[model samples]
Target: MGSNGSDPPRPVVGITAYGEHARYGVWDNESVLLPRTYPDVVIAAGGVPVLLPPVPESAAAVDRLDAVVLAGGPDVGPDRYGAAPHPRTGAPRPDRDGAELAVLHRALERGIPVLGVCRGAQILNVALGGTLVQHVPDVVGHSGHNPSPGVFGTVEVALEPGSRVGAALGPVATVRCHHHQALDRLADGLVVTGRAADGLVEAVERSGAPWVVGVQWHPEEVATDVRLMTALVRAAAQNRTTAP
Candidate 1:
């Protein structure tokens, strides 16, 4: 992805890749994978999408990204929040957990723009000492948030006026959602910027920070909602120009 004559370089957006077991081509295999829509949406938003596998050099790799997407995946282990695992909690992956946390910490320290989606948003809260409602349906009175295993359901969210997410999007939006967890206690310095009809926190933004945001719904899941990614890319490009 590029610009017309003399335009600035597109921001390099790094998206986290999760490891999974798969069968493809000639063999059953262990693979690093990301949904095509994630990167495709990024490119359409005028950014360079780079897949970032969990690695020992993750923090350093984060240093190189102009922006980062903490892609959705398995649950954050209860240990990170110092609690016993809830019955519905997904099995833990220390590798994915460790790698993304390192990248997040480094990115925050450097003030790089960051977007956290679904599990990404959960971990962003966890990373900042907030807790999560392990099984959202148990609290919300419906399994509609995640109608089935690996399925997305539609829901409406109301955005806070004058908030980052509200400003990027409008006062309300119907979005694609697929998750069993969401933010519990508010993280320090992170403000709730959106909420679902059931009143669960749907979005958060860090005040006084350079473009840090988290959304409980998957904006990448739908091609039409590229505003979030575009906002992130714009912030990233601005950060690049202002960086010393």
Candidate 2:
């Protein structure tokens, strides 16, 4: 339904898409349009999904949505977060890199509810002047974080008391992991809310914002995981209603 000034505005979430190729050696150089499972998660939680395509200008993309989601994808460029490439770091997609960074920067400035997942989490950190551990196995020398490539691993996360994510997800929660990269140097105002058994950071949220959280897990992969998407959609709904 359209907002006619009498009705509340429906929350719109901008989800970032990924680029693809046949092989690392031969770049297909074609935009790969894939749907993120999170948008369906958002829809199930009562929000609208606006696939935020790779745009040259981020501000314009961010302006159309009340909230934004940085979906999981290829590893972020090492140089972006002030690090050198690791053997495990996937080749960077420049188009996605430019689009997401733009959207993240504009979303932060606009006070939009931004949820970052996996690669999305890393993007959030980099956009906010933070860094990442290129390869968890290489740095931590452990396989608990990600046991199998593209497969979900079960891990318990201890949530910090008084954190938004903690409150939303209760004192603690067992979330699914699929990425090798993890949060390292936290961005300013971003407080680590959840951590894995290996002491790797799993979740982060803005200190003062109503909603700005990033998780190094795949909540969307599990439709039963409602709290994460619910919290996001709720914040987006509220933001849209109160948008000036």
Candidate 3:
């Protein structure tokens, strides 16, 4: 990990949006009340927390953010990665997909640091020409991965020695997650940094970037898991100056 110079005094980080299912039309609700305790996590890490709306005007959104976060949400569209929908695939939201793709593209093009969680991780894969398992049970031959359909379950992740993820969370660790899909083909330029006990991919990262890590877990829910947020914020602060 290389440092540009003395770190900037402060930086602003943006968390991606998640749509709401209101009674009327999709009310386009915003996450002002703080999602998954991420606001406190960012503030504790010495950064400002900004809730990013699902507005796809890349330049406008990307310009104001020193770093961007892709938070966990609904499943990514299977068609985005050249596959048919799975029997167990959840509702697909094309609007959210398009908006996030634009945000991701703008961030990557500007060399901004990004941290993806759960569905955000899948989105990272699809954005780079990769595919997903649709439903882990159908492929992994087990139902433990998605234990209770919509509940968090513990999984052991095998981390590659000397990988960025390993350095962040240690050699091997257990993480809590709730998902039905897993990565099938890794995105180009992305290396699998961790995997579940059932041999499913758990985390990935770019080879030489400051911080391009994505995990299949909701680290924000575990406030004690400070490493996840620390690593992300540190990398974002680094990119603010060294971004190319």
Candidate 4:
């Protein structure tokens, strides 16, 4: 898992990307967008990082990767979980919702490790037949989940003593966060592995063969806790060897 010549072939990780109106150079046009830090951290963790733009074909691409990083983006459409949009919800992105859902379905079926960050976490919950709080301020009584605009708020997170996240990053830690929503009705098989100081569901995982987890904070933002990403690459390597 090293970048050196003697290292074994690294696990290939396909990271999800979104389409947005972006500004670069002197041009302002709609374009595919992905934070470079996500892939940079993946490479630093000894994985081959590939940015997967939002497209229907993402389902097929999911098959070729050993792991998937569902990057943070817009709010998932409320209709995905049979709820009406919250007054605080941003504009819908049903097209993107469909694309990532397909990736999640295929990754789970193929036993590929998945790390869902921020918006990715919400999407994970929805993909597994769960719902989101839609507006954390409404549920938690404040903007603790997202303290400010364009800034990563710090929050203390307590991990379940025997949970996968706990094993990866210890029992208690601080994480960088920037989100307005959190998990509500968890999927049946999914277990809450961590919580914020305000009791928001900050982390979750399905206890089984395939490594699957969703974190409400942005570890990639501060590059502070790379254990989750590292764990995924490690699992991906193991999956590669055992893959037929």
Candidate 5:
């Protein structure tokens, strides 16, 4: 049924998009793009999805948003965390790195709810003085977390009871993942809330924020579950209602 006139406005949630070379119809060119799943999940969770392209001033757009989702993409530039790029690390996208880092900081400064998925989780860590594993197989001795390109692997994550991620996803979740890097040396004020059996950090959240969760898995790829996104939207709704 449609909402009555008394219903509140849907919260606007911004999802970051990356610039990439692509082809469509008769033209092949660089494009600002994001997977459709990100917006679809946000909409399913009762939030309006807005795509934020990687631009120097994109951070300013956060001022008009109720929440933000740092969508998954390329590996965060190793230099962002004071490290040399691993031989396995993909080439860096400076524009994307700068834009996302700025956007994340602004969102936190304003106390906006944020969800970081896959590469987004890595971005969250690096944005807050943390480092990354660089290559997961080197540490875990297996490629299960990221079996192959364009293919998502399923990994079980154990959530910490009472944590925001756990509250939304329960104690254990079989999540979709597709990344070779994971959080390491967590930034101050960020707590690990979920982990894989191999002890890789799978999720983290800001200690004092109302909602700043980052998951190493790709929740958007898990079409059957919308709990994580729903939690973010609900938090955004609450933020909208309580903002001064």
Candidate 6:
């Protein structure tokens, strides 16, 4: 099913990957990793996926991409926002944090469409001078958002009407969530677009253009819902066609 020189080219989406030590095929080594679900959703949404490893120079690649996705990972360092690390906070991955912040800043400058999932969303906030709650259960008084290891909890998020996220996910959505931290103070030029019943921030988006959206939940975890990815792909396509 090759293109007959008619349809537009598929947008190239760059997704950030995690650098972790893993055991694979009897070999234990450090590797760049990302779940298959991220690329799978991108492809299903008519975009080509490229994995961006945590490297200082990775931000340079944003100029060559139509859009970017910040995938979920470990908790961001509290020092990023001048806060002391909470007892429950995960250790920082400096390489990942620096690389992602660079990529995000670059993408925003280029007006590239960006989607942040889980920790990706947190990265976006911290990069813009915002802070995180550090531990959700401490404030929310429950562990429903992250029931246990390797298990995703279901959360009902109320979307802000007329928001970009709402346009893609509708007024209310039952999302797959697995996070222990969430946005505390939103950055300038960004607004909260979704929240859980407990008033925890679940989604945020830029107030103006370029199509930046971040969700506390992992949209890729839900195979049945491709709306969010589709929306990103569509924005990327538009960016590709309109870029001067």
- Where in model 4 is the C-alpha error above 4 Å? 4-6
What pairs collide in candidate 6?
A: none
Where does model 2 exceed 4 Å of error? 1-7, 22-29
Model 3 reaches what TM-score against the true structure?
0.88
Instruction: Name the runs in model 5 displaced over 4 angstroms.
Output: 1-4
- Judged by lDDT against the true structure, how good is candidate 4? 0.89
Rank all candidate structures by their lDDT, best first, as comma-separated numbers.
6, 5, 1, 4, 2, 3
Output the lDDT of residue 173, model 6: 97
How would you encode candidate 5's per-residue C-alpha lDDT over 100-140 as one tens digit per residue?
A: 99999999999999999998999999988999999999999
User: Residues 214-237, candidate 1, lDDT per residue (tens digit)?
Assistant: 999999987977998999998899
1 against 3, candidate with superior TM-score: 1
- Cα lDDT tens digits, model 6, 68-99, are 99999999989899999999999889999999
CA lDDT of 188 in candidate 1?
A: 90
TM-score-wise, the better of 2 and 4 is 4
Clashing pairs in 5: none
lDDT of 2 by residue, 1-244 (tens): 2447986656888888776544435555566465557678878777788777777665587888878888888888888877888887888777888888988888988888999988898898888899888888877787877788666888889998798788888888888888888888988878888887778898998887659999998888888777887888888777767778
Q: How well does candidate 5 match the true structure in TM-score terms?
A: 0.98
Q: What TM-score does model 4 achieve against the real structure?
A: 0.96
Point to the candidate with the largest lDDT: 6
- Cα deviation of 121 in candidate 2 (Å)? 1.1
Q: Global lDDT of each model? A: 0.90, 0.82, 0.80, 0.89, 0.92, 0.94
Residue-wise C-alpha lDDT for candidate 4, range 1-244, written one tens digit per residue: 7767998889999999989999999999999888888988898787999988888898899988999999998899999999999998999997789999999999999988999999988889999999998888888898866888887788999999888788888999788889998899998889999998788899999998788889998878766557878998998999888877
Q: TM-score for all predictions?
A: 0.97, 0.89, 0.88, 0.96, 0.98, 0.98
The TM-score measured for candidate 6 stands at: 0.98
CA shift of 79, model 1, Å: 0.8
User: 20 in model 6: Cα distance from truth in Å?
Assistant: 0.4
Q: Model 1 reaches what TM-score against the true structure?
A: 0.97
Our tally of clashes for model 5 stands at: 0
